[model samples]
Target: MKTALRTTTKTGTFAQALEDFKQITKVGLAVSVVFSSVAGYFLGAETIDYKVLLLLMIGGYFMVGASNAYNQIIERDLDALMKRTMNRPVPSGRMSVNTAFIIATVCAVLGIVILYMVNPKTAMFGAISIFLYTSVYTPLKTKTPLSVFVGAFPGAIPFMLGWVAATNTFGIEPGTLFMIQFFWQFPHFWAIGWLLYDDYKKAGYYMLPTGKKDSATALQVIMYTIWMIIVSVFPVTGLTGRLHLSVTGAVIVALLGVGMLYFAIRLYHEKDNAAARKLMLASVAYITFVQIVYVADKFIGGY
Candidate 1:
């Protein structure tokens, strides 16, 4: 009985630790970022190299995980004040700050080293992303609403980072990818800000463009959504280098944009949390489907 009890306790402890790690690193968000990187790689590579692709996946996850971990550490107290974040590992006392810091530091170093194996530029951008997220965006969250704009920089890099990893170049192709993601973030994050406004206020976070959930903020979301749609179809213009899109792909992407824009417009008219939540979901689907369409167009459409 004693031995069995000890084994059970050990297993329970390990399981809890794993759960804490996932919460701290935000595994879902990290995976989506990796997905974007992989899609960009597919768009740029003439022939796939499995080894480099694997490196990008691992390195990208570690970098994003490190950034999230550091952000949690910095915002532990503020996190405790917000219901949405109060259950997180550090804020809930499931994990120690020092432990989280060590994990973050290790992940950052390993991520940069692995990305360096892919290319120096990949590693450099990875480092810049971490710096921007933790150093700039994290601190600015409580200070000003413009932090959303600043946060978009690191958020936008993963898509282009994949292209750079494949081509070792920062040309119009990667630039287009960057712009698409950059513009997309405003609507995506604003919807989240709308839904979580009350919780964010508890932590003194100013996430909305207008510092309030009003028509002005909704208008900006619509405007940025329009810009995101325009950029998503820009590859059809044949100016995005090897990242060309067929007319069919462009039309499908525009349709997806319209679907997302419908949700945004609903939020504008309804001005309710439900509408904002729907817009948020639509934004996620739009970005993922748009990336799929772009990659599919390149491979299947032969454009």
Candidate 2:
């Protein structure tokens, strides 16, 4: 009986530790960022270097993981105030600040080192991303509505990072990618803000543009969605040099944009959490679908 109890306790402890790590690192969100980075690499690389790709994937995840850890540390108190985040590792007392700091430091060092193995530019950008996310975005959450704009800087970098890692230069092609992501974040993030407005208010986070759920905010969401769609279609114009989008690719992106716009419009009309939730879901689908199409077009349409 004693042996069985001990085994069960150990198993439970291990499982909880795994869960704590996931929550601390935000595994799902990190995976999406890495996926975006990989897509950028594929789009830019003349020939895929599998070794460099491996390093990018591993290094990118650790860098992202470090950013998330640091963000939690900064928001540990705010997180405890919000219902959704109150149960997270640091806020919940499942992880110590010191432990998280150690994890972030290790991840940052190793991530930068691994990225440096690829090239100096890659490493430099990786470090900049961590710094911007932790130092700028995390604190700005409570100060002003402009935090979203500031956050977009680091948020938009992964796509461009992938291109830079592959090509080792920041040019028009990667710039186009950066612009697409930069604008996409407005609606994507605002919709989340809309859905969680009350909860975020608990933590004094002004994630929305207006801090109020009203027409002005909704109009801004719609406008940004339009801009994001416009930028997404620009690559098909051949003006972006290496980042060409064929005819079919253009149509697919337009369709995806329309889908997101539809939700944004609904959110405008309703101005409620239900509409906000739909928009949020649509925004995720739009970004993921558009990214996949962008890469797929490179292969099937061949510029």
Candidate 3:
């Protein structure tokens, strides 16, 4: 019995550590760092610096990780109330609040240091992203539907973070990238809001525009999705100068936008869990592929 109990304790400890890591490094945060790094590469800075790129990724990771850690700490009780999040480390009692706090603080310091080393502007933005995400948006989620909007500010920073990392300056290129991601987030998050409406409600999260999974919210999803596609194609117009998309690349991007549109329209018409799920999947694919195409266009010259 003693040996069996010891084994069980060891297993539990390992699982807790893993869960803590996931809560700190959310998949969305990792994806943002990757896409933004690629965007920085494509922005065609006067000179490419792989060292800066490495720092951007490392710094981005810590900023995101810290924010997520703090979020879990703040929402521990609420997270336990939600089925989808009940298994989270803090809420499940797998990890203590004090441990999470220390980890978050350390990660934030490391991230800021790396970003500052890369460029002061990038560091400033990284700090701002963490502040907005942890202080403003996390708490606002339970209070107002506008939390989504506030959250989008930090959520959209990764794309721009890359640009600042590369150029050490904010310009039209980063602005355009920011706009594209900013618009895309509404539809993407709303679809998630729709799918997780029940789970979110259990935890007092007001994710949707109406805080209800109805036609009203679905319509908003469609509207923002349309806007997302439009802004994504804006670069092709050459209106943004340094961020211009060639004709061929623009056409390819448009086609990808149409694919996202199809999913958005389906969600609008169907409003079912399956449709929402599909839209969520498509939105993830859309943003990731769109960024990839944008970067590839610059290098491959588009087919």
Most accurate candidate by lDDT = 1
Among these predicted structures, which one has the highest TM-score?
1
lDDT by residue (109-198, candidate 2, tens digit) is: 998999898889889999999999999989999999999999999899888889989999989999998999999999999999999999
Model 2 gets an lDDT of 0.92
Task: Please list the C-alpha lDDT of all candidates, in the order they appear.
Answer: 0.96, 0.92, 0.84
Instruction: Give stretches of model 2 more than 4 Å off.
Output: none
* Clash pairs for candidate 3: none
* RMSD score of candidate 1 (Å): 0.6
Indicate whether candidate 2 or candidate 3 has the larger lDDT. 2
The C-alpha TM-scores of every prediction are 0.99, 0.98, 0.92
Give one digit per residue, the lDDT tens place, for model 1 in 1-303: 999999999999999999999889899999999999999999989889999999999999999999999999999999999998999999999899999999899999999999999999999999999999999999999999999999999999999999999989898999999999999999999999999999999999989999999999999999999999999999898887888999999999999999999999999999999999999999999999999999998889865
| lDDT assessment of candidate 3 | 0.84
